[model samples]
Target chain A: MRIAAARERKHDERRVAIVPDTVGRLSRLGVEVVLEHGAGAAAGFSDAAYAEQGATLTDLAALAPDLLLAIGPPPGEVLDTVRPGGLVVGLLGLATDDAILEAVAKRGLGAIALELLPRTSRAQSMDVLSSQASLAGYKAVLVGANLLGRIMPLQMTAAGTLTPAQVLVLGAGVAGLQAIATARRLGARVEAFDVRRAAREEVESLGARFLEVPLDAAEGEGGYAAAQSEEYLERQRALLAERVAEADLVVTTAQIPFRQAPRLVSGAMVEAMRPGAVVVDLAADTGGNVEGSRPGEIVETNGVRIVGASNLAAELPTHASQTFARNLANLVELMVTDGELHLDDELVRATLVVDGGEIRWSRPA
Target chain B: MRIAAARERKHDERRVAIVPDTVGRLSRLGVEVVLEHGAGAAAGFSDAAYAEQGATLTDLAALAPDLLLAIGPPPGEVLDTVRPGGLVVGLLGLATDDAILEAVAKRGLGAIALELLPRTSRAQSMDVLSSQASLAGYKAVLVGANLLGRIMPLQMTAAGTLTPAQVLVLGAGVAGLQAIATARRLGARVEAFDVRRAAREEVESLGARFLEVPLDAAEGEGGYAAAQSEEYLERQRALLAERVAEADLVVTTAQIPFRQAPRLVSGAMVEAMRPGAVVVDLAADTGGNVEGSRPGEIVETNGVRIVGASNLAAELPTHASQTFARNLANLVELMVTDGELHLDDELVRATLVVDGGEIRWSRPA
Candidate 1:
């Protein structure tokens, strides 16, 4: 089996699909690794380092491999270069991106979209969403603390005593839980909210208070919160405003994947916050969970700083790339049995979007 | 008794001598407070906030009071506005800045320089240096962590395990000790070094290892480490290089008041550090302890980031201003007994730089 690593095409996307260490891991599995020149440069991995791990490097024009590993869906022009029936693996988001699925079907490519990986104990090792969300959540707290006018920890100095900053994390997913943990590590008093009652234990385990809204459970598919009724969302927003007003920092990570992110924080809630309070909206790229969040920008709305941070995982590229590459390797390892590609595994069946010259949509359970 | 505050005149100097909360503290002492209209604006305390605390707001040109409280020495023209024989208090470096001392002497202004406060148990409450350095130390860790390409804490994910970052702090003084504590709180393995043997206990108490260098003790007057000989400094540099090379983040905060800060980390040492290593020099304003550091700037040399972070305390203006104001208020409280200025206490005598028509130079022991 042969695999090629492709450079990420998105602007400011520094994460590479594989690191030098992962290149070495794949080579040990009887796989021939190929890379386009400078593929891992942005992630602090050099071509020479890849060569030391028994990988071959070549220009895109000279690149033709049996399998292509990417961070996102490969650009259309690059997909044209892949041999017909060759495999393409990445966070293809085929369920949401119709155009990518159409092109993959036209090219007769075998596409494996990691985002469709089932949330099961067996598939946990190949979960890219959880790995990347962990990094984003940690980075969000750092951004919020840096922009804050007050220090995070309480200090009792010779002059006086300063109270610790109060932090609130909205949503109790992987990202929100990580934010709560990071904020607690910095000595901030943290609180978290979630529509799912199951998230309450996770929030409390991280030394944070779980905010209760007294609403019906809105648990969604795949262990995520499903879309809520309009009335529930309105009441949830009203209850959250009182907590938001008392917080010195709020990190919003309420994302619904393919749909627009639910608005959890309102404009009036921001106005009620103390001057110099900071809000980091991680869902800004998919329409923010905060009322006034602008994607990829920091804006001040009535003395509250709203930082719409998109692609926060890219900010910590070294570790993010390292963790993500392992996830990719685990999925590829399942597909190749005894140095031959085998798609009979149920995991492969669930993730395959394009195979055998047709778009194969398998709804993930 | 009446006191007025002058707005800071230095570029990027945002901290005010007083905050609204402290205005009420002074009011109870029967002191009528006057202010320059926008003195507290940069620190997030509005003019109306001060007025609500019974402070009278007025333009700087019309400021005439019995006492002037300031962060830095007021410009000569502004000093001339004060009534003759009136008192002035702040972090006025009278031991240095001969020009300012001369003007104070010529103008017959009663000046109490906080920089000269004795390092006694009783004097600790009025210790402005210790109070401000605590904020600077906390911020240095935050700035270093934010700029580094890796996360500070050890993370265990489904993909793999990441080791914690290694941190080194030089000069285990108030600032250095706080930096070590802050970095440890963020899950970094920290090490510290100080010429004073007494610092070893403080460093170890904070859950950080104390680096041992075989050398003679160089303890100095007023609880500060004395200057070392040329040969001693050279030998110390060689010993520190090995440790510096191993650290992911190094924060240097060694300084002698009114003297050029000691050169602790050499340029060769920084070059030997791994790529993406960060070195934050908190002594940059008084001649940085790191060779390549420039005041108020962040630069990269040989792939090592050197942040010349002078005035780091001012960056967190809200808490910085609050703590600093309380320190000033404590010193002022000792001067006024029964609604009259009483300079009989030795604490005031030691802090007073210029009294009557003569410059009273009291060398703090």
Candidate 2:
């Protein structure tokens, strides 16, 4: 069976669905990997690298394979060029991709939206969200530190002693924990907050202090954070504001899936921060965790910089694409056997959004 | 005794000669501090902060005092506003600053050039070059990592293992060693090269491999790497090119005092770097260590990013200014005894570039 990916067309989407390392994995599975010319250019994967890995570099029109891969959902024009009844897989933002879902249904094609994959240990290797969020968490601290006016680490020089910066990371999930780890590695005194009590051990394991909030049972289905009431959010923000006022760098990653990001920092809180303090909102694309933050922009309030970070993982395109390809390759390992594809595994079945002229998945309750 | 500083006017210069922390230190020395309004604003110090430390904030014309402070050389008009025969201290770039030197000499005023200060144990506390270079070194890695297309650290995620980046730092001087430390903190495997054989121990202590070239006696006076012969530089470049090609990030900080920075990474070497690799030249302002590097700009050659980092310490203005002010204060401590300024100490005499209508110091032999 042949699998192929065209160059990602979405602006600011630097990550490709395939990398050279993953090409060998698919090739080992008796899969012919075809890529459109310049498909991995933005992600630092040259066509030569793919060719060296025994993958074919061809025109978009000639990329009619049995399976099509993408980072973003491929446009209808590209989808129409796929082989009849071919399968397509990507981070199909199912909630907002009605047009692609309808087109796939009408064409009797198969679609696998990785975002809908079950968050289980058996499917952990294919968990793109966890992988990408970890990168976003790491990038958030880097972005904030880059904007800060002082060094993150302390120095006792002949000139004088420079105190370490105070870093406050909001959330204790994959991204928040990674942010804490990165900040701690840079010698910043890190403090993290999360409604999920179970995250405390993980946060402390990284040598960071986990701050406690009074509310409990904020854990949602699949170990993700559930939405909170307005009163709970108000109390949480009140506690965070005091800590944020003293932070040199703040990275907020308090995101609830398929919902607006919880606002954890108020405008007054940002204003209270000293000049040159930086706040990076990892949830900026889905509303924001800080007031006055806009997607993909930096807002300054009273000498404090609030960066609305969107698609931060994509900024580290080479590694982002590497892990993304590996995730897809892992799923392919389960489905492809004896040089033939079978969609029998429960892990594979869970990711199927559209198949056999019918929509297979719906928004989880 | 009174000391005052005017806001810097040079383009791209963000550091102030005095920070609020040093104002308190000076105040205890019976020195009445005066500052032009917003003198430290660019460095994140406010008038209120200075005022809290018993410093008077006023207009530039009204800052008549016994001593004037600056980051860059104060322009003629501002220098003319100082009290007659009063002292001025700053990084007076004596060699190329003919106009400022002439003006100071013509006015019969005393000037201290921090760059020319003796590098001795007694003067170590007042070593502005080492202090600022340390900050620049730390910032160089940050700037390079920010531009890189992959994460600096490694990760073994469920998706796959992401390898740590290979960072090559050239010239194991103050800046290069700091860059190595910062990269190692971020989990990058660093390799550093230096003409000075003595730098190997320091580089290895920071958990980085030292790439040694078969050379001897490269060390100059005062523990600084001296200028090398043309043949030595040519041989060094040949050795560095092979390592530079394999690095994900390269930071070059090989600078000779009062001399052009040696070209370590040739244009051909940069072109050999893979796409998305980054090179930050800390000596960019002093004729770059990398070929085609323009001061204060990012030059992309063959898809490799070459950052000509000028005044990197100024980018971290808060800490840069804090240490700068402390250095100046330490110098003041020895010169200003019993509430009066004296120019008697050998260390103080070593820094005097101009005094009594004559240039007191000349280019080193």
The DockQ assigned to candidate 2 is: 0.82
Deviation of model 1 at A253, angstroms: 0.8
In candidate 2, what are the lDDT values of residues A67-122, reduced to their tens digit? 88888788877787688888889998765445778888788888999988888898
Give the docking tier of candidate 1: medium
lDDT of 2: 0.88
Segments of candidate 2 deviating more than 4 angstroms: A95-97, A213-236, B214-238
User: On residues B1-365, what C-alpha lDDT tens digit does candidate 1 reach at each position?
Assistant: 77889788878878899899889878777878889998987777788999999999998877886788888777887787787788888888564564677777788888888888898989998888898899899999999988776789999988888789999999999999989999999999999999887899999999999987545444435222323556666666777898999999999999997778999998899999976789999999888999989988998885679999978988888888888899989988888765578888899998888887588775444
Candidate 2 lDDT over B19-94, as tens digits, reads 8888988888888899999988888899999999889999988998788888878898778877878888999876
Q: Rate the local accuracy (lDDT) of all candidates.
A: 0.85, 0.88
Candidate 1, which segments miss by more than 4 Å at Cα? Answer: A57-63, A76-84, A93-99, A102-108, A214-236, A356-358, A361-365, B76-81, B93-99, B102-108, B213-239, B356-365
